[model samples]
Target: MYQRILVPVDDSDTSRQALLEATRFCHNQHGKIRLAHVINLAQFTWGGAEFVDVGELQGNLRQSGRTVLEKAAALMQENGVEAETTLIEIWGGTISSAIIEDATNWPADIVVMGSHGWTGLDHLLLGSVAEGVVRHAPVPVLIIPIKRKK
Candidate 1:
């Protein structure tokens, strides 16, 4: 029985599945759902560019994050889950840290996320975001792997 279930989503199918699962669990248990999307600041890396203004990048990323969260919210609504969505676009931080911070601050009862993202080689080189979150998250985390067509 979860009170506040938090699901971190992106523009990926696996993330969408995580949302579906979280919503189903919350709906059955009469719990509230929190849909969260963290726009990683490192996504705009320009290979040692000197004039990287943190403020400008954060502004752009914030808008993008909001757009992503809006779609997730729409999906939740379609599934009959009235979720309270949160868009956190922090500057100069790791995705795992951003997620962990939100989970701690929001005090979510559970965290559900996709096992991996769109990053292919990068994930292999730098490890997976879901893995990182699970390693550092203070609360319970459930990782759902992206379903690939056979």
Candidate 2:
């Protein structure tokens, strides 16, 4: 019974699954889907060289981000789901804050996202973005773990 659904996506396969799931849910509930992709400026920028030209690189990455959003939007369209999408370029920091900011600012009813399924050392070392979002989000959060095939 979700009205306005929010799904944060990246270029990862897990995010892709989230998109698909959000689309299906939107179709079932006749809700509007808000697809968002946050571009972390630090991660998107190239480092190492002090004198290296980064303007072109940043521009290209922004363009690529747009393409990704368009692609996701196309998937929703093909599935006969009406959706509105936004691409946000934010400074690199904790993803939790960024996600929470979007949820609060956009005033999303619920957040639907896919867990990266980190385990063992990776889980401990990197922690979980999904978990952070769940803990900090003002609204309900639905985290879908990617089904790994054996």
Candidate 3:
């Protein structure tokens, strides 16, 4: 049970917390992890001729994503969890979609991730990626949420 765990990581405290939780979950069994980082290219508006500096900006995003994945992988290693990393770049899609697609392809037993646990105005403004994952994920999702600071 839960032999293949998929974790979506970012450079947030909640994301790190999720990674740690996944590490703990995989420590006892013959479990392995696939760490995923999704980058949304649509957030950037690249205009002007020659595509402006779009390529450079995209490169930066990829680098940043790679760094995040690397750190997550290192954390898993520190906890003695076997983990691999994948980066998904989408020009016009939701992060949750990318995550679910990967989870399905990897055939993960579960998805362990961290959520901001936003609510009220914050939830409305930021929207919840974890909520989307919980709604549509092919595998069971374990969301580790960080408390909101006042």
Candidate 3 wrongly placed segments (more than 4 Å): 45-51, 147-150
For residues 1-150, write the lDDT of model 3, one tens digit per residue.
Answer: 678999999999999999989988889788889999999876666445265677677889999999999999998989888799999999887999899999999889999999997889998988898999999998899999895679
Candidate 1 lDDT by residue in tens digits, 42-113: 666657535787668767878888888999999888988888988886667687888889999999888999
Q: By how many angstroms RMSD does model 1 differ from the true structure?
A: 3.0
TM-score of every candidate: 0.83, 0.88, 0.91
State model 3's lDDT: 0.90
By TM-score, the best candidate is: 3
Q: In angstroms, how far off is 122's CA in candidate 1?
A: 4.7
Of the two candidates 2 and 3, the one with more favorable TM-score, higher being better, is 3
lDDT of 2: 0.82
**Better candidate by TM-score, 1 or 2:** 2
lDDT-superior candidate, 1 or 3 = 3
- How are the candidates ranked when ordered by TM-score, highest leading? 3, 2, 1
